[model samples]
Target: MKRIMLIVSYNGANYCGWQKQNNAISIEEVINTKLKELLKEDICVIGASRTDAGVHAKGNVAVFDTETTIPPEKIAYALNARLPQDIRIQESREVRADFHPRYDKNNKKYSYRILNTKINVPIYNEYTMHASNYLDIELMKNAAQYIVGEHDFKSFCAANTGVKTTVREVYSLEITKNNNDIITIEITGNGFLYNMVRIIVGTLIQVGTGKIKPEYVAEIIAAKDRSKAGPTAKAKGLTLEEIYY
Candidate 1:
């Protein structure tokens, strides 16, 4: 059997999450079902990242072993024909049979989008978080700088994540606003704990609103207490932007 790696993109609005679950549809379940139909074999894909429900992905990776004679490069087109419009296989290629997408990952980048408007913009509601308060991007950027290097990210992780360790390395963090007033917070890191990105964004929002000073972020990180940070941002605003191997 040969392992094929697939680059998947999906709109997470209709699925429970990337992982399969009983009594609910998921991006993974759908992909598995479609692959089974296409290859006439039970195919299960191991995703590089198990993104949470309502979290979209632009370049999530997955790998599955198959015995079919189909060309690797053409699998994307064949799979797209079977997948729903909301989920597309961007690319497919052969990989070493031992390559594990999750374990082989180098780093990933996530983007949290905020629609900074007094009134909700219905058109962008599904993908962007609507924020009524004015967020000072410059202050947010200043706060982001404090967490740029390797450190224990316990303050940004979920309260009960149950991970083996809370330490992680953040390569970069950027908060920017476009002309349309949509604020985008992009963070790149070696790995992330559950809800880490969301918590960081929430804490940065506090700084933007003058509730927390930019320089105070260093203290929050040093505290390493979940309660010391701001509220976790909603999942809808967060997207798995890219994964690098």
Candidate 2:
């Protein structure tokens, strides 16, 4: 059997999440179902990240082993025919047998989008978080700087994750606003705990709205207490922008 890697992109509005679950339809379940129909073999894909429900992805990665004679490069085209319009395989290729999408990942970047406007645009509502207040981008940037480098991110992580360690290294965090009144917060790191990115965005939003000073972010990080951080941002605003392996 040959191991195949697939780069997947999807609009997560319709699915429960990336992982399969008995109670809800999920991206992983849909992909696996399509693969089975296309190759006529039962298959399941191992995804790099289990993105939260309603969270979109532009370049998520997954791998599956199959005994089909289909060309690896053409798998994407073939799979697209079977997948729903919301999900598409951007690229596919052969990989070493031992290469795993999750464990072999180098780093990942996620972007949280906020539509800072008095009137919410229906077209952009599915992917962007709507914030009515005027956000001070400069203040948000200043707070984001304190989040860079190694630190205990317990405050930013969702509770009940069961992760042994909360310490993680953040390579970069940036906030930018476009002319369309859309604000984007992009962050890159080696790994992340559950809801980590959303929490960070929530905390930054607090700073932008003057709920907290930029320098106060340092105290929150040092506290390592989840209660000290801001509320978790909505999942629909977050997108897995890219994955580096």
Candidate 3:
């Protein structure tokens, strides 16, 4: 058997998430079905990240074991012909037989976008979170700095996450606004807890809107209580940008 790794990208507007489910459609299920039909083998991919529903990805990774004679690099072209337009195989290649995507050491980067204007753009509605009030970008930037190092991120994670350790190291976090009044919060981390990125973005939004002081972010991190942080932002605005091995 040979292990093959695939770099997959998808617009997650219509699927439940990356993992296969019993009653719902998912990105992994769709790719697995297509691969089984192509290679005539019962194949299931192990994804690197389990992105939430309505969250998109540009460089998500997955690996599967197969015995096909097809060239590893050629699999991407053949797979794209069968995949939906929203989901495409960017690259595929063979790896060591023991390689696994999830257990490997890697850094993930994600971005959250917000449309901070009074009116919504119809074409971009599905991709961006809309906030009608004016946002102070400088204040948001100030709050993001506190999140740039190792800390206990339980305050930013969802309740009942069930993870044994909540401490995570964030390499960097940045907030920037575009000319069209779109604000983007980009973060790179060694790992993240459930809903951690969304909660961090929401807390920064609260700082920008004067609901919370910029200096209060450190206190929230120290509290390690989920209730001390702001609400979880909507999932549609978040995207998995890249993964570094």
Candidate 4:
């Protein structure tokens, strides 16, 4: 058997999430179904991340072992022919037999987008979180500074997460705005707890809206209480931007 790694991207609006579920469709399920059809064997994909419902991905990674004679470099082209337009396999290659996408990830980057304008653009409605009010970009930037280091991110994670430790290292965090009134918050980290990116975006939005002081971010982190953080941002506005191994 040969292990093949695939780089994938998808618009998550139409699927439940990345993982296979009992009553819903998923990206992994679709990929596996197509792989089975193409290779004439049952296949299961191992994804780098289990992104939540409505969350998109630009550079998600997955791996599967197969015994087919097909070359690894041809897998992307073969899979793309079967995948829907909303999902695409960007690249594929053979990997060392022991390489596991999730366990071997060196870092991951996520980005959350906000449409901070009076009117929402029809074209981008599915991709951005619309906020009618003007946001204080400076305050959001200030709040982001507090998140750029190793910390126990209990306040930012979803309650009931099975992980025993909430500590993660934030390599970088930045907020930027464009002329089209689109605000993007990009964060790179060693790892993230469940719902961590959405919570961070929500807290930053509170800071931008003056509901929370920028300095309070540090306090919230120190408190290690979920209730102290802002609400979780909408999943549709969040995307897994990249993964490094």
At residue 122, what lDDT does model 3 achieve? 71
Range of the 10 consecutive residues with the lowest summed lDDT in candidate 1: 97-106
Per-residue lDDT tens digits for candidate 4, residues 1-245, read 99999999999999999999999999999999999999999999999998888999999999999999999999899999999999999999999999999998579999999999888887887789998878999999999999999999999999999997999999999899998989999999999999999999999989999999999999999999999999999999999999998
**Clash pairs, model 1 backbone:** none
Q: Which tens-of-lDDT digit does each residue in 75-187 have in candidate 2? A: 99999999999999999999999999998857999999999998898889899999999999999999999999999999998888898899999999988999999999999
Worst 10 residues of 2 by lDDT: 100-109
Q: Write the per-residue lDDT of candidate 3 for residues 79-126, one digit (tens) a residue.
A: 999999999999999998888777789899999999999888877787
> Candidate 1's residue-wise lDDT over 1-245, tens digit each?
99999999999998899999999999999999999999999999999999999999999999999999999999999999999999999999999999998988579999999999889989998799999999999999989889899999999999888889999999999888999889999999999999999999899999988999999999999999999999999889999988987
What is the lDDT for 134 in model 4? 83
Misplaced by over 4 Å in model 3 are none
Q: What is the number of residue pairs that collide in model 2?
A: 0
Stretches > 4 Å off in candidate 1: none
lDDT of 3 at 208: 90
